[model samples]
Target: MTKTYEESSQTGDFLEALRLAVERARTEHSPTDGMIDWRVAAIRGQRGGIAGLNLITVVIEVKQV
Candidate 1:
């Protein structure tokens, strides 16, 4: 599973943050069955501005076979 977020900053810091989090989770064996089959989790940003940002958080629950 994966979660994503976006911000209006000129630098790609948020992307990097999400990538690092996923990588850490994968390495730490937090994902079900030790593998990532799809994006089962997500936190998306719907709005952004110079002062702040608004986001819609999505949570995906997975079941292992």
Candidate 2:
């Protein structure tokens, strides 16, 4: 089986946002039913536009073990 996960973050630092997004991708894991492989499905980013912080989104697909 496979599953898809999406996580987004808006922060002043681009790397921090990306790191957070990836860190949030997997909330939990188990030895018997854990992810064996991960593939990046998409990445989207938008400018803060002056009033808001920059937005970064990351999508990933995981293959079950």
Could you say which candidate leads in lDDT?
2
lDDT of 1 by residue, 1-65 (tens): 33432223233345554555445545544555587433435555455688555544333333333
How many angstroms is residue 36 displaced in model 1 relative to the true structure, after the best TM-score fit? 2.5
> What are the clashing pairs of model 2?
none
Q: Write the per-residue lDDT of candidate 2 for residues 1-65, one digit (tens) a residue.
A: 76766767675454565555455545543445433467777788887667775777777766666
Q: TM-score: which candidate is best?
A: 2
> lDDT of model 2 at residue 46?
80
lDDT of each: 0.45, 0.63
TM-score against truth, every candidate: 0.32, 0.60
